[model samples]
Target: MQGFFHGYAMNGIDAKNRVSVPSGYREVIEARSHARIIVLAPHEREPCLIGYDQAYSARLYEKLDRRFGDDFGPERDDAARRQFGATEQLGYDDNGRIVLSPMIKELGELDRLAFFIAAGDTFEIWNPNVLLEVKGASDPRLARIVRAQIEAKGGKA
Candidate 1:
C-alpha cells in the first residue's frame, strides 16, 4: 500500500521555479512505482494548484467521464475544456524537478515562496504565508474531525 501523504512545509519556489519533492515524500510515492505527476490549476476560490500521481489522475479522468459524459453542453463544456482539460502537463527532469509554468505560478501567487503540501494521492502548491494564516485560523473542531477520520481509517495521526 502507498503511504499516506503526511504533509510537509516547503519554504520557497527555488530559482527556475523548481520545487523539490522531499526525499522522504518521494520515497513513499516512488515505492509505488509512480514517477509521473499531473499539475492542474485547482478550481478553488483562491486559485490554488493541485497535483496528482499518474494513476490517481487516470482514475479522476475516468470518474469525470462517467459522471459528466462526453457531452458537455457548449458553454459549460468550453469552460471545462479550457480549465481542466487544457491545463499544463509537466514532466520531471532528470533531477526529479519540474518547472512550474508562469500561469501556475501566477495563479498560486507564488513569487519567491511557495509550499508543497502532501495531500495524499495528490498534493497542493500553496502560498506559504497564506497557508499558515489559513491553518492558524481554522477551528480546532475541524482538527478533531480530521483526527477522528484518520484514526478511524487506521491512519497514523
Candidate 2:
C-alpha cells in the first residue's frame, strides 16, 4: 500500500526559491502518482500553500464539477477559476527540489524557510513565523512544533 502523509518537516529555501520536499512525503507522492509531479495551490482558508499528487487534483476537479453541476454562472466560474487556474503542476528535480513560483512565494509568504505539515492526502507549505503567528496563536501543539523548528535552526525557522 502507498504511504500517507503523517509528519512534519522544515527546510530552507534557497536563493533560487527552491526547497526540498521531505523524503517521507516524496515516497508517498512517487508511489501513488508514479512521478515527481505535485500540484500546489493557495489554500482556501489559510495563508499557506497546499500540495498534493496530480491524482488528487483530478479528484478535486470531479468534486468541484459535481458541486456545480453545469451551472454556467459567476459562482461556478469563480470556483472553477480558483480550483483549476490557480493550481500549479510542478515537477521536482532528481534532488527533490522544486522552485517556488513568484506567486507561491508571495502567497505563501515564504522567505528563507518553509515549514511543512501533513494533512492526509496533502501537505502544507508555510512561512514559519506567519504560521506561528496565525495558527500557533491558538493551537498550543502547533506552537510548540514551530518553536522547536526555530530552535533547531538556531532561531531561524
Candidate 3:
C-alpha cells in the first residue's frame, strides 16, 4: 500500500473528466477500507486537484476538528467545515474511470488533458501544460535534489 509513481506522462482526460487511476497505484488505493476518495480544490498558487483516499481524509478532518474546536463566532469554523465538507467521493466507473466533479475539473483547469502524478498518501491531478511549465521551471533544482539523493544512496545519478 506504500509506493510512489513520480514524473508520469501527461495523459488524456475524458469528456466527463474521468481519469484512470494509475495501474501501478491501484493496488495501494484498493487497500483502503473505502475505495471512496476526497477531492479538494487546489490551493491558489497550485493548479492541481488533490485526491485523498478515504482514511487519509478522515484523519485530516479529525485534525482540523481538534485544532479549530467548534467555535463558530464569525462562521470561521462553518467556513472551514464547508470547504472540507465539499469533498466528493470518487470511484472507478464501469470502464475503470474515476469521475471528477465539475468544480474540481475547473479548479485544476483540466480540459482534454490532465497530468496524474503520485503524491505521498494521495494522487494529484494537474493541467498538462501548466504542470509541464512548472516542472520545466523547477527541473534544475529537481535534478540537483535527485542527484543529491542518488549520491546519498551511493550511486551515480
- RMSD of each predicted structure: 7.8, 1.5, 7.5
Q: Give the Å error, residue 113, model 1.
A: 1.8
Q: Which 10 residues in a row give candidate 3 its minimum summed lDDT?
A: 1-10
The RMSD (Cα, Å) of candidate 2 is 1.5
Candidate 1 regions off by >4 Å? Answer: 1-3, 28-33, 70-72, 75-79, 139-157
lDDT of 1 by residue, 1-99 (tens): 566566654544677887665555556656654765545566455546776555555566676677678677786566556546736667666566668
For residues 1-157, what per-residue lDDT tens digits would candidate 2 score against the true structure?
3677889988999999999999898889888889899888999999999989877877888898899897879999898898878788889998899998988789888888899999998999998899988988689899899989978977754
Inter-residue clash pairs, candidate 3: none
Residues 57-86, candidate 3, lDDT per residue (tens digit)?
667777767767876565666756655765
TM-score of 3: 0.71
Q: CA lDDT of each candidate?
A: 0.61, 0.88, 0.62
Total clashes in model 1, counting residue pairs 3 or more apart in sequence or in different chains? 0
Model 2 weakest 10-residue run by lDDT: 148-157
Top of the candidates by lDDT:
2
Give the higher-lDDT candidate: 1 or 3. Answer: 3
Q: Candidate 3 vs. truth: CA RMSD? A: 7.5
lDDT of 1 at 24: 56
